[model samples]
Target: MSDRLVIENLQVSYGSGAQRVEAVAPMSLAVPAGQKLGIVGESGSGKSTLLKAVLGLIRPPGVVRADGIWLDGTDLRSLSRREFRARCGSEIAMIFQDPVNALNPAFSIRDQFRRSFRLHQPDLPRSRYTETMLRALASVSIDARDKLGRYPFEFSQGQLQRIMIALACSSPRLKVLLADEPTSSLDVTTQAQVLDLLHALQAELGFSLIIVTHNLPVVAELCDRALVMCRGEVVEDTDVISLFEQPTHDYTRHLLASMASLPRIASGAAS
Candidate 1:
């Protein structure tokens, strides 16, 4: 498969001069179409920072620099702020750790979904937006099509996350989906279901998947390749099996040894 997203010399920082902190060191990676790549790191390891920097989500007082960030042959860095924001969700989408904070509580589900439709298809008929949203909801097995009038607070955490996934993946133009700690906030059973939704959706939609999390089992279950990070640096880059069987980095080995719930990695299935 061809590369859907490519990054070169990406770096991020906050503050200035002596106080300037390097949130993410320069790193490069390419995600091929339909590939699932997991980035594993502890909290503050800069994995999430890397994902945000690629999406240009870092705010003022924070700095994001990259040699290039190309999505589907288009260098995202070349786009204006408006254009870049437009490219997100339409071509590349991100799912956050918590849907509660990620989604606005002020808007009804219908309004939020309508805005998503508008983002992905600027000229999509207003009349079709509702049906389109219903279809997206159904894709995730949510029976909330008619309940679009409900607010984000009305749904369970798992239901809201499924809706979040549907919102992120609804666009046909989408080529890459970046999930940051997507399952960390959910119960074990819900986490499994959400991960399965992500895997199945990626397969059905043919989008490259990049997940950043501390969950080793999630990586083993959903990813083909894994990147182990610590102190804003990649300590190990290998296939999932190698990552589990022959960890090259001391940190990686320690992480593996500490896990109490190791899934059957060879089966290559999410629990």
Candidate 2:
């Protein structure tokens, strides 16, 4: 199958001349249709910047330049902001790290779903909206009928994340899902649940996934291929099994070592 997404020599920079700083150095990668790819990096390692560039979310003073960012056979940079926004929920969707911040506290779950539905399918009959919302929630194993009237603060963190996933996956045109540190804030059990939900949804919906995270275990569990970033560059790109068995880059080895030592350090401290 052809690649679903291809980014070539993409670069993102802020400011100009003496004050300029590159958030994402020129880098490139591709995701095959229905593949699960993970980008692993520390904070400020340019993972988020890469995602923002792909989404056209970078504001002025922060310039995003690329040879090409192709979705299917289309180059996304050719599209205007309005045109891109129109394609957001259906063509490409993002699930942010913090679900609470992504949601409006004042709006009920039903209202949130309505806004999302309208954004992607504005001409659809209002009568079908409720059923759509219910199905979306059910896909993530949430009780939509009981929770639709509740506000954002009414649900637990895990539930909120599931809702965010539901919202992103609801559109029929959704072919790719970009998740940014989605499980970072949840407890271990909740993290596992969310990961399982993500995998199940991906299997059922057949959307390609690009997950950005610092958590190695999460990547190992959810991704087939892994890209390790350091100092705004992709230092290592390999299959998840190879990444663990033999990391080529010194930085990648260090990261793996750090993760490995954490449990021992905690045990020593406790004893």
TM-score of every model?
0.94, 0.93
Clashing pairs in 1: none
- Candidate 2 versus truth, CA RMSD in Å, comes to 4.0
Question: Tens digit of lDDT per residue, candidate 1, span 58-85?
Answer: 9978898898999998999999877887
lDDT of 2 by residue, 1-68 (tens): 77989999999998999998888889988899999999998888888888988988899899998999
What's the lDDT for candidate 1?
A: 0.87
Question: lDDT of model 2 at residue 139?
Answer: 93
- Which stretch of 10 consecutive residues in model 1 shows the poorest summed lDDT? 262-271
lDDT of each: 0.87, 0.87
Give per-model CA RMSD.
2.2, 4.0
Q: Give the TM-score of candidate 1.
A: 0.94
